[model samples]
Target chain A: GAGVSQSPSNKVTEKGKDVELRCDPISGHTALYWYRQRLGQGLEFLIYFQGNSAPDKSGLPSDRFSAERTGESVSTLTIQRTQQEDSAVYLCASSLTGAAANNQPQHFGDGTRLSIL
Target chain B: LAKTTQPISMDSYEGQEVNITCSHNNIATNDYITWYQQFPSQGPRFIIQGYKTKVTNEVASLFIPADRKSSTLSLPRVSLSDTAVYYCLVGVGLNDYKLSFGAGTTVTVRA
Candidate 1:
């Protein structure tokens, strides 16, 4: 409960279906990030939100992938018309400060494991 | 963003000191090096971070040489529970939010 919390730890869906993964960051963290980790691979950054500033969505793979953060409390990553390649562990992390501060480390949640069939 | 390279895997025994090295030849002046560990089904957990010189925390030690071109993550008296995938990331203060985490090194601690 103290750490970052993610919902629906596991989800299985059809290839054409849509799914939303939620993340609740630490109480006062101002920076939030979303990442995707495929099996036997490294994490791929999806999006980043720093306070109320515009989100950095450069890492988004396509138009179908989008994310949003409500202030600094909760964030959600959505995938529309998901494909089999969309299957992976969606991770959420939060930091006290944005990436501009190198010393601040990001705390991560266990993540939501999504399987697209 | 600087590119980082680490070993594919390593094997160590309990009570031994495991040192995993990462190379970042084109690191920038403002880039900081950070390490994270991940278990089978969990997100990465921060291990340690350093800009230059050496930094030590309860979980691990991060050693960065003067050139800042390479870093080593040292785990002392490692136990079987230390077995996991370790990632070395090279960017944080470069104003680049999308930090790259190349395929990490898998360290297996044996009894």
Candidate 2:
């Protein structure tokens, strides 16, 4: 089966600019998540979307970071007024279902490496 | 979410088995243990997951004792390609779906 797909494998932008990263979850996957990984650091959870439920934005570092998922298809993580600290690989993942209790492992996309100057 | 602890790194040779253990002393009854592998410039890939006892897949094996405070991921006869970062995560079914990943153990396989 095809895996989750992320666009703009690499993106370099100036500070204060806005950047949008895209993710295409696997077919039939009802849950999607976004994460950030700084160099030499573990992944930091960003946001999650489960079916029709309200997206979990608790992990968003600041108001500048936001994500939206349309139905169950695609998700876009937008960083407004990007800062140097926002430079990192943005990863997206999806599972067959949400609620984690079911033990469905998330499948991940390679991710988008964002660089801010 | 339960916090997990794992080694910083491990060194091994091709054909040798590698075992990375993770500790989650505060694991909840509903929490499950899962492992992920990531290569350079790639996203983490699920290796194996288990709630208790032992679970084995074509890629790796997960061993959890009755206490469930800790779990071990065993990769049998690893090859050079097995060199990657192995993350041990505990905390599923919380409906949060946000996995708290600590610095994973970097396994370097040398021929």
Candidate 3:
């Protein structure tokens, strides 16, 4: 792909229902990140992956939130038993290399607008 | 990551230059200053990054002082399309690169 890609641009579900958000990084990009932006709030980092290394999950809000990536291709973020507070834009970004963060500019997708009813 | 502070919003006119300054009092020596611009319903895009002094690109310029405590993002010849929220970020490293965005400075470029 020319840039990072995310699936299901918009997802609306009832409370307690689980949802899966997918992300496809740019070709050969070694770093992928997931973030969320709640209404009227700043972006909150969820997690990050550098190649095949164990992802950094310190930013995950709760045990209900988990993510995984295979090699360096695609990533998935799953929210179990979603809550009303989970409503926000789920953003995915990828960089050329995660080894040097400042040198690599992340390219973001359009993001999935998750609405919990 | 170093904490950053910026104005809530600002208004500018077309053909004028717009400058948004961000302050990071606890910036570390290894940290680099970076700026991003985001439009409504879209994700943020990198504008520029600088370690010290000045760095310029086709999109914008980042000016950092000797103290490295603050930096400014200068947008030249602004237009209506330049209206967006600008974010200033620091502490971009390989080990801990999680970016924490502030309220951001909303620049409204009017015709």
Candidate 4:
């Protein structure tokens, strides 16, 4: 892809239902990140992936929030049994390399706006 | 992560130089100051970054003082299109660490 891409720009699901958000990062990008932004709030870190390395899942809000990345390409953020509080804009970003590279900026996607009814 | 503080909003006339400052009182030695601009319903776009002193790019300039306690994002001669929310972030690393976005300063460039 030309840049980080996310699917289903908007999603609305009832409470207790499940939702999946997808991200397609730029080619050759080794670092992928997921963030959540609630209404009128700052962006909250969710997870990060670098190549085949173990992902950092420390930011996932709860057990219901989980994410997976295949190699260094596409990533999926799955929210099980969604709650009203889970509604937010899920953003995905990718960088050329890891933290050691100072110039690599994290390019972001338009994001998926999830609404949990 | 170093916590950052910035203004919530600002208003400017077109063709004005707008400077938005962000304070990071506890910035670490290894942290870098980065700025991002976000439009409505869109993701943030990187503007410029700096480790110390001043760094300039085509879009903006980042001025970090010697103490690194605070930094300012200078948008030169901003136009109506430059009206957006600007974020100041301090990150420990380029990749792994989370870049926290505080209540960004919304710059409304009036025509």
The interface RMSD values of the models, given in order, are 1.7, 1.7, 1.9, 2.4
lDDT of 1 by residue, A9-110 (tens): 999999999999999999999999888889877779888889855458888999999888886689988999999999999999988989778667788999
Off by over 4 Å in 1: none
**How close is chain A of candidate 2 to the true chain A, as a TM-score?**
0.95
Best by DockQ: 2
- DockQ of candidate 4 is 0.55
Cα lDDT of model 3 by residue, B13-106, tens digit:
9999898999999998788888999999988887898999999999998999999999999999999999999999888776646777888999
Evaluated against the true structure, the overall lDDT of model 3 is 0.88
Clashing pairs in 1: none
Q: Which stretches of candidate 4 lie over 4 Å from their true place?
A: A100-103, B94-96
For each candidate, report what fraction of the true interface contacts it reproduces: 0.68, 0.71, 0.59, 0.64
- Best candidate according to TM-score: 2
- Give the per-residue Cα lDDT of candidate 4 at B4: 87
lDDT of each: 0.88, 0.89, 0.88, 0.87
Best by lDDT: 2
lDDT of 4 by residue, A1-92 (tens): 49789988999999999999999998999988899988888889998888856457889989998888886799999999999999889999
User: What is the Å distance of residue B32 in model 1 from its true position?
Assistant: 1.1
- Worst 10-residue lDDT window for candidate 2 chain B reads B92-101
